[model samples]
Target: MAQTATRHAKLWFAGQAENWALAAYEIDELHEGMEDAGKYHPTHKQIKQAIPELIAQYVDQPLTALEQAINAKNKAEFIANYDKLTAGCNACHQATEFGFNVVQRPSFNPFANQAF
Candidate 1:
Protein backbone atom coordinates (compact mmCIF):
# COMPACT_ATOMS: atom_id res chain seq x y z
CA MET A 1 0.00 0.00 0.00
CA ALA A 2 2.79 2.40 0.82
CA GLN A 3 4.46 1.64 -2.50
CA THR A 4 1.19 2.19 -4.29
CA ALA A 5 0.81 5.56 -2.60
CA THR A 6 4.27 6.62 -3.65
CA ARG A 7 3.69 5.55 -7.22
CA HIS A 8 0.37 7.38 -7.20
CA ALA A 9 2.04 10.62 -6.17
CA LYS A 10 4.86 10.15 -8.65
CA LEU A 11 2.40 9.40 -11.40
CA TRP A 12 0.72 12.74 -10.73
CA PHE A 13 3.95 14.66 -10.92
CA ALA A 14 5.07 12.81 -14.05
CA GLY A 15 1.83 13.54 -15.84
CA GLN A 16 1.72 17.14 -14.65
CA ALA A 17 5.19 17.69 -16.02
CA GLU A 18 4.15 16.07 -19.33
CA ASN A 19 6.68 13.35 -18.83
CA TRP A 20 4.74 10.66 -20.63
CA ALA A 21 7.43 8.00 -20.41
CA LEU A 22 7.69 8.26 -16.64
CA ALA A 23 3.93 8.45 -16.28
CA ALA A 24 3.56 5.27 -18.32
CA TYR A 25 6.11 3.51 -16.19
CA GLU A 26 4.37 4.59 -13.00
CA ILE A 27 1.02 3.44 -14.34
CA ASP A 28 2.46 0.02 -15.12
CA GLU A 29 4.00 -0.16 -11.67
CA LEU A 30 0.72 0.78 -10.05
CA HIS A 31 -1.14 -1.88 -11.99
CA GLU A 32 1.38 -4.55 -11.09
CA GLY A 33 1.16 -3.60 -7.42
CA MET A 34 -2.61 -3.90 -7.49
CA GLU A 35 -2.38 -7.27 -9.19
CA ASP A 36 0.10 -8.50 -6.63
CA ALA A 37 -2.14 -7.33 -3.81
CA GLY A 38 -5.09 -9.16 -5.29
CA LYS A 39 -3.07 -12.33 -5.80
CA TYR A 40 -1.51 -12.37 -2.37
CA HIS A 41 -4.51 -11.27 -0.37
CA PRO A 42 -7.59 -12.38 -2.19
CA THR A 43 -9.71 -11.62 0.82
CA HIS A 44 -9.37 -9.61 3.96
CA LYS A 45 -10.95 -11.01 7.11
CA GLN A 46 -12.66 -7.68 7.79
CA ILE A 47 -13.75 -6.86 4.27
CA LYS A 48 -16.63 -8.84 2.80
CA GLN A 49 -15.66 -8.29 -0.81
CA ALA A 50 -12.76 -10.08 -2.43
CA ILE A 51 -9.71 -7.88 -2.97
CA PRO A 52 -9.54 -8.70 -6.69
CA GLU A 53 -13.21 -7.94 -7.15
CA LEU A 54 -12.91 -4.63 -5.40
CA ILE A 55 -9.90 -3.69 -7.51
CA ALA A 56 -11.63 -4.67 -10.72
CA GLN A 57 -14.65 -2.60 -9.83
CA TYR A 58 -12.85 0.49 -8.65
CA VAL A 59 -9.51 0.70 -10.42
CA ASP A 60 -9.50 -0.99 -13.80
CA GLN A 61 -11.62 1.36 -15.88
CA PRO A 62 -10.04 4.52 -14.59
CA LEU A 63 -6.64 3.00 -15.14
CA THR A 64 -7.54 2.23 -18.72
CA ALA A 65 -8.66 5.81 -19.22
CA LEU A 66 -5.46 7.05 -17.70
CA GLU A 67 -3.45 4.93 -20.09
CA GLN A 68 -5.36 6.34 -23.04
CA ALA A 69 -4.90 9.88 -21.78
CA ILE A 70 -1.19 9.32 -21.49
CA ASN A 71 -1.00 7.77 -24.93
CA ALA A 72 -2.68 10.81 -26.38
CA LYS A 73 -0.52 13.17 -24.35
CA ASN A 74 -3.66 14.98 -23.35
CA LYS A 75 -3.05 16.90 -20.14
CA ALA A 76 -6.65 17.83 -19.41
CA GLU A 77 -7.91 14.30 -19.93
CA PHE A 78 -5.02 12.94 -17.92
CA ILE A 79 -5.80 15.22 -14.96
CA ALA A 80 -9.50 14.38 -15.05
CA ASN A 81 -8.81 10.66 -15.19
CA TYR A 82 -6.16 10.99 -12.54
CA ASP A 83 -8.73 12.45 -10.15
CA LYS A 84 -11.09 9.65 -11.09
CA LEU A 85 -8.35 7.13 -10.27
CA THR A 86 -7.71 8.84 -6.93
CA ALA A 87 -11.42 8.73 -6.15
CA GLY A 88 -11.41 5.02 -6.96
CA CYS A 89 -8.56 4.47 -4.53
CA ASN A 90 -10.46 6.34 -1.83
CA ALA A 91 -13.61 4.43 -2.63
CA CYS A 92 -11.78 1.14 -2.26
CA HIS A 93 -10.36 2.28 1.05
CA GLN A 94 -13.85 3.24 2.18
CA ALA A 95 -15.19 -0.15 1.15
CA THR A 96 -12.51 -1.85 3.20
CA GLU A 97 -13.36 0.34 6.21
CA PHE A 98 -10.07 2.12 5.73
CA GLY A 99 -11.59 5.44 4.85
CA PHE A 100 -8.93 7.22 6.85
CA ASN A 101 -6.47 6.31 4.12
CA VAL A 102 -7.65 9.05 1.84
CA VAL A 103 -5.47 9.80 -1.21
CA GLN A 104 -5.28 13.09 -3.06
CA ARG A 105 -3.16 14.89 -5.63
CA PRO A 106 0.32 15.57 -4.39
CA SER A 107 0.66 19.15 -3.13
CA PHE A 108 4.44 18.84 -3.07
CA ASN A 109 6.94 16.52 -4.61
CA PRO A 110 8.57 14.25 -2.06
CA PHE A 111 10.85 12.47 -4.54
CA ALA A 112 13.46 15.17 -4.74
CA ASN A 113 16.09 12.68 -5.83
CA GLN A 114 14.18 11.74 -8.94
CA ALA A 115 13.27 14.38 -11.50
CA PHE A 116 9.70 14.20 -12.62
Candidate 2:
Protein backbone atom coordinates (compact mmCIF):
# COMPACT_ATOMS: atom_id res chain seq x y z
CA MET A 1 0.00 0.00 0.00
CA ALA A 2 2.83 2.34 0.70
CA GLN A 3 4.25 1.76 -2.75
CA THR A 4 0.83 2.23 -4.24
CA ALA A 5 0.52 5.53 -2.43
CA THR A 6 3.86 6.66 -3.76
CA ARG A 7 2.95 5.62 -7.27
CA HIS A 8 -0.37 7.37 -6.94
CA ALA A 9 1.32 10.63 -6.04
CA LYS A 10 3.92 10.18 -8.74
CA LEU A 11 1.22 9.51 -11.29
CA TRP A 12 -0.51 12.74 -10.38
CA PHE A 13 2.67 14.74 -10.70
CA ALA A 14 3.60 13.11 -13.96
CA GLY A 15 0.20 13.79 -15.44
CA GLN A 16 0.11 17.32 -14.13
CA ALA A 17 3.47 18.02 -15.69
CA GLU A 18 2.22 16.53 -18.95
CA ASN A 19 4.91 13.89 -18.77
CA TRP A 20 2.88 11.17 -20.44
CA ALA A 21 5.61 8.56 -20.46
CA LEU A 22 6.26 8.82 -16.75
CA ALA A 23 2.53 8.89 -16.06
CA ALA A 24 2.12 5.71 -18.06
CA TYR A 25 4.93 4.07 -16.13
CA GLU A 26 3.41 5.09 -12.83
CA ILE A 27 0.03 3.79 -13.93
CA ASP A 28 1.59 0.46 -14.77
CA GLU A 29 3.29 0.42 -11.39
CA LEU A 30 -0.01 1.18 -9.73
CA HIS A 31 -1.64 -1.71 -11.56
CA GLU A 32 1.14 -4.04 -10.52
CA GLY A 33 0.81 -2.90 -6.93
CA MET A 34 -2.90 -3.64 -7.04
CA GLU A 35 -2.20 -7.08 -8.44
CA ASP A 36 0.35 -7.75 -5.73
CA ALA A 37 -2.08 -6.61 -3.07
CA GLY A 38 -4.73 -8.99 -4.29
CA LYS A 39 -2.28 -11.81 -4.71
CA TYR A 40 -0.65 -11.42 -1.30
CA HIS A 41 -3.77 -10.51 0.65
CA PRO A 42 -6.72 -11.99 -1.11
CA THR A 43 -9.02 -11.42 1.82
CA HIS A 44 -9.15 -8.95 4.60
CA LYS A 45 -10.76 -10.00 7.85
CA GLN A 46 -12.79 -6.81 8.18
CA ILE A 47 -13.94 -6.76 4.58
CA LYS A 48 -16.56 -9.13 3.32
CA GLN A 49 -15.42 -8.95 -0.30
CA ALA A 50 -12.13 -10.25 -1.55
CA ILE A 51 -9.43 -7.63 -2.14
CA PRO A 52 -9.31 -8.45 -5.83
CA GLU A 53 -13.04 -8.09 -6.11
CA LEU A 54 -12.93 -4.69 -4.47
CA ILE A 55 -10.16 -3.66 -6.85
CA ALA A 56 -12.10 -4.86 -9.85
CA GLN A 57 -15.27 -3.14 -8.70
CA TYR A 58 -13.63 0.18 -7.98
CA VAL A 59 -10.20 0.68 -9.54
CA ASP A 60 -10.26 -1.14 -12.83
CA GLN A 61 -12.59 1.12 -14.79
CA PRO A 62 -10.83 4.28 -13.77
CA LEU A 63 -7.52 2.73 -14.62
CA THR A 64 -8.77 1.89 -18.08
CA ALA A 65 -10.05 5.41 -18.50
CA LEU A 66 -6.72 6.76 -17.29
CA GLU A 67 -4.95 4.69 -19.89
CA GLN A 68 -7.17 6.07 -22.60
CA ALA A 69 -6.58 9.59 -21.40
CA ILE A 70 -2.87 9.04 -21.46
CA ASN A 71 -3.05 7.64 -24.94
CA ALA A 72 -4.99 10.63 -26.15
CA LYS A 73 -2.81 13.06 -24.22
CA ASN A 74 -5.91 14.76 -22.97
CA LYS A 75 -5.25 16.78 -19.87
CA ALA A 76 -8.91 17.38 -19.05
CA GLU A 77 -9.79 13.73 -19.29
CA PHE A 78 -6.70 12.75 -17.38
CA ILE A 79 -7.54 15.04 -14.45
CA ALA A 80 -11.16 13.94 -14.38
CA ASN A 81 -10.31 10.28 -14.48
CA TYR A 82 -7.53 10.74 -11.96
CA ASP A 83 -10.10 12.02 -9.51
CA LYS A 84 -12.24 9.01 -10.29
CA LEU A 85 -9.29 6.75 -9.57
CA THR A 86 -8.68 8.55 -6.30
CA ALA A 87 -12.34 8.14 -5.43
CA GLY A 88 -12.11 4.46 -6.19
CA CYS A 89 -9.19 4.19 -3.84
CA ASN A 90 -11.16 5.93 -1.13
CA ALA A 91 -14.17 3.76 -1.75
CA CYS A 92 -12.13 0.63 -1.31
CA HIS A 93 -10.53 2.04 1.78
CA GLN A 94 -13.95 2.82 3.20
CA ALA A 95 -15.19 -0.65 2.37
CA THR A 96 -12.20 -2.12 4.18
CA GLU A 97 -12.78 0.12 7.21
CA PHE A 98 -9.76 2.18 6.33
CA GLY A 99 -11.68 5.27 5.39
CA PHE A 100 -9.36 7.39 7.45
CA ASN A 101 -6.62 6.62 4.99
CA VAL A 102 -8.16 8.91 2.42
CA VAL A 103 -6.00 9.70 -0.57
CA GLN A 104 -5.85 13.09 -2.23
CA ARG A 105 -3.82 14.69 -4.99
CA PRO A 106 -0.28 15.37 -3.95
CA SER A 107 -0.02 18.84 -2.47
CA PHE A 108 3.72 18.84 -3.01
CA ASN A 109 6.24 16.51 -4.53
CA PRO A 110 8.45 14.72 -2.02
CA PHE A 111 10.50 12.81 -4.60
CA ALA A 112 13.02 15.55 -5.15
CA ASN A 113 15.48 13.16 -6.71
CA GLN A 114 13.13 12.30 -9.56
CA ALA A 115 12.05 14.88 -12.10
CA PHE A 116 8.56 14.43 -13.38
Residue-level lDDT of model 1, residues 59-109, one tens digit each, is 999999999999999999999999999999999999999999899999999
User: How accurate locally is residue 23 in candidate 2, as Cα lDDT from 0 to 100?
Assistant: 94
Model 2, residue 33: distance off in Å is: 1.0
Candidate 1 deviant stretches above 4 angstroms: none
lDDT digits (tens) for residues 2-76 of candidate 2? 989999999999999999999999999999889889999999777889999999999999999999999899999
lDDT of every model, 2 decimals:
0.96, 0.94
Write out the backbone clash pairs for model 1: none
Can you list the residue pairs that collide in candidate 2? none
